[model samples]
Target: MNRLFDIFRNKYFLSTAAFAVWMLFFDKNDMLSQYEYRTEVHKLQQEKDFYEIETAKVKKDLNELNTNLNTAEKFAREKYFMKKDNEDVFVIIREDAKD
Candidate 1:
């Protein structure tokens, strides 16, 4: 009984147990790293969702352009500042009132 208790309470055993606890809970590759990795994964998922929505919108616009000449011309004029020949275009710039 005394030998068993001595083995259980020995300095080497205690130090090894403490080291294991430290490595499992406080080391560089532990719970904190897992939490950080989860956060990064969530951020990437959100970005992917946002890009998917934007891609859907672009695809819808592209499909519309294929079948709609008026929409295509409007998109080209608004986005690319295109104008017909012999047509005059005026641009109005708004200025902030507060200095």
Candidate 2:
């Protein structure tokens, strides 16, 4: 018991222990801050991955559109309501569908 008390009473040990406790709990960049930073980094990585996947899909679609005249025409007709001369287009809408 006396040996333990003597170790605790040493100035160097006391100061080092106090500093460690303060740094772990009360510093500006503490354990909680580190955890939050890791969480934010993970979220940004997920967003980057999602954007990369979407970019790949768009690139594939663009490549197909540039390579095929039929695909280009189909995309134009479906996406932009484009039609050739003397063509009638009918758009069907469901009343219960959400926009």
Best by lDDT: 2
Model 1 pairs whose backbones collide: none
What overall lDDT goes with each candidate model?
Answer: 0.92, 0.96
Candidate 1 lDDT, tens digit per residue, 1-99?
A: 999999989999999999988887999888778889999999999999999999999999999999999999999888778899998767777998996
TM-score of each: 0.67, 0.76
Model 2 gets an lDDT of 0.96
Q: After superposition, how far is residue 26 of candidate 1 from its true place, in Å?
A: 5.8
* Model 2: CA > 4 A from native: 80-99
Question: Model 2 over residues 1-99: C-alpha lDDT tens digits?
Answer: 999999999999999999999999999998999999999999999999999999999999899999999999999998889999999888887789688
In model 1, where is the ten-residue run with the lowest total lDDT? Answer: 87-96
Ten residues in a row with the worst lDDT in model 2? 90-99
Model 2 residue 42 distance off true place after TM-score fit, in angstroms: 0.7
